[model samples]
Target: MSISARRHTRMATVAIAGAAAVALALTGCAGPAEKPADGEPVEITFQSWVPNIDRAVDAFNAAHDDIHVTLETITAGPDGGYATMLSAVQAGNPADVVQLGYDAIPDFLINDALEDITPYVSDAKDLFVPWQWQTGVFGDKVYAIPQASGPLGQFYRADIFEELGIDYPKTWDEFYEAAKVIRASDPDRYIAAFAFNQAPWMIGLAQQGGANWFVPENDSWKVSIDGPETAQVAEFWQKLIDEDLVKIEADFSSEWNADIQNGDVVTWISGSWADAILRGTAPETSGKWAVGAMPQWKAGENVSATWAGGSANAVLKGSKHPEQAAEFAVWLNSHTDSVSILTEIGAGWPSIVDTAAIASLQDAPEVFEFYGGQDIWDVFAESDKAVDTSWSWPPLSSTLFASLTDNVKAAVDAGTPLVDAYAKTQADMVAALTERGISVD
Candidate 1:
């Protein structure tokens, strides 16, 4: 398939010259120009959005005498700073290793910018969960290593649940009942904060049944946005908002932060990344929070799972030191000490599953003190097992999300019928994907 007209247009604006200028200004220098001697230290540029990743690189540098990683902060933007890295790649000055979102891999694959890491996977592949290893594969080739896995779960205020005398919900129906009880206890305080404006929630819901909305069928991919399972989940959330059981927030911003800190929002559906947010944003509420398995369809439905979001390290194809870069990527992702450093600083969950780092985390005297002594690692580990490998974000997901935000707000705020709103979203997604040359039929 040809590159989408819109994507092509964007690429044209970032011509080689324009990209070179941007790269020089932003990165200061192109990646290490010459290969270092066997005994001489080798330095490679490592770019990522996570702030604590530098500590991991530092640990790697300290441990290894041959290779040293120079950490670069990739600024976060609407696309999570992917556009900047894409421009760098176009200019033939990409970083040695870059952290990429799972959804962003297809575009890199089509552009031939990502280095196939199949060669390195043989030794380290078994160290990670099966789904983690599968996350970077496309057409039998692996382009990246999974840095972290996000298994969705319910992070709730244990104090609020105790105050309301409600038991932790084990099923969806019970979950709803718990929400109602929390709401009844106080009209002003909501049982949960549903950021209906965010696309992650929709993606999480679709993955709840381990169903992929866009699946390969014969020669083309088929989209099932209005599938019975997804539609039910959407309608339920819609009702939650309409009935005032849940508060609709715009996004994770200042107001949302206040709500969480002040206990205006009692429950939130989030992945492992949320642990950092809870600890950082509401230190006073430490030990007041507890995580539970994601509410499943029934007691024993398919493994309880949802979407996973985290960055992976990949070597760009044009790098001068592909071998060194590939080795750096492997060391950064697979080494237990590096993973432990990243997790200790609260960047995100470690990508390598079943590492001693996990046990070390469990032993931290203060780890669960933030969650009222709840064993968060155990909760997250159980949730990790439930992650569905089939769940993925569409290539043109950003554009589709822009369309859904406006229409979903209209439905939630103006009392529009849920079915009508969903129908409109489906049509908009089809149109958007069609314009991008992605088959939605």
Candidate 2:
């Protein structure tokens, strides 16, 4: 019935001056939202980027006579929605509920943008995965409801690996050897692309290698983007770049799309959700692709990580109906109807405790057929279990991504070692956090 000591310590650091300002704003600007009149449903707005999620909202509205939710579709957070939401928060009006990536929870918490929904949703805590549920909790307060997850995995061109006599890599060392073989076999083909432009993918790799880039420490953050475990990941990828064993390319670009279609880029080390992207990008290459668990750091290790795709629904600070909003968030994610719709739409893997009970997940024939008849969901389920629960995202994530991307791009352009970018990022993060009046340990 009590919060863990680790979480107690972590959340203590989130109550900064920004949080104080938000608390004052909430108390001074608005009182508790009043209940609706007799026979009138409480109306609330929900903002999200997940395609076809509106259908789930419709289902909720039809099923619940007490609450009616309006779905306001927006661009994915990284593209623009985060700024839009923050602006609304600053202006003293925001949607009743909004979708946010797991990593963004800390930033929202530090800014006090989210409402404490603990009193409303704590009873349903056992319905979802524990680690994911924790993503929404700061100290002892729950600010969000877990909806989806992004367990890391490998999506590869199975035909190419077979043709080159290379088995699916099970370890990082074996992956390097496979990279060498793929390059030596065909000048144009490589094992995977070095996606320096994508910060989340790079961070996921470091996480898989036991890197905790950010740690909560005594009411401050211990910044360690250049730690030893991260160094191992950087050096491994840098070796691939130096040897020309992998293509240096930005993902989802015209060039990268062409490579994926033509089999030049043989593998994509991304989240389980990538299967849908690959299917949409290259429908002509069906049955050529397959899925595998992320290659381990050592021969038998089982560490995994979450990509940026996992998201949660949080009630904003200024909502007039936080109680109804929290109820809708919980029902929409846990109910079979909503979870099935989410699965059909290729929303990231659901965070429900009983994934097996979801029929859509158990028998997705079309999805299996696309990936060479392999049940890719099985791989993701295992990867989800292997993920380290200790990994935590820091505040100022937007700054973190921009700094890492710019520094890494500069390094690549200057022909400097890619590992140097992490060190540079270390300095950039500390400066930015200090300027914002956040303590760095």
Relative to the true structure, candidate 1 reaches a TM of 0.86
Worst 10 residues of 2 by lDDT: 21-30
RMSD of each: 6.4, 2.3
How high is the lDDT of residue 77 in model 2?
A: 56
Q: Candidate 2: global Cα-lDDT?
A: 0.84
Could you tell me the C-alpha RMSD of candidate 1 in Å? 6.4
Residue-level lDDT of model 2, residues 188-237, one tens digit each, is 98899888789999889999999888777677778899999999999998
List, residue by residue over 1-441, the lDDT tens digit for candidate 1.
112222322322222222233332232233445867778887778888886777878878888888778888977534656677767777777787888766565555544567666775657777766555555665455668777766788889999888888898877788888878888887678878777677666667667855556654432446676677777787777788778888778547788888889888888888777777777888888878899888777886635554435557787766767667777877777787777766666555667866665544657666678888777877777777666655545555555566666677787778886656656777887776565455444
- lDDT score at residue 390, model 2, on the 0-100 scale: 75
Task: List clash counts for every candidate, in order.
Answer: 3, 0
List lDDT for all candidates, in order.
0.68, 0.84
Prediction 1 global C-alpha lDDT: 0.68
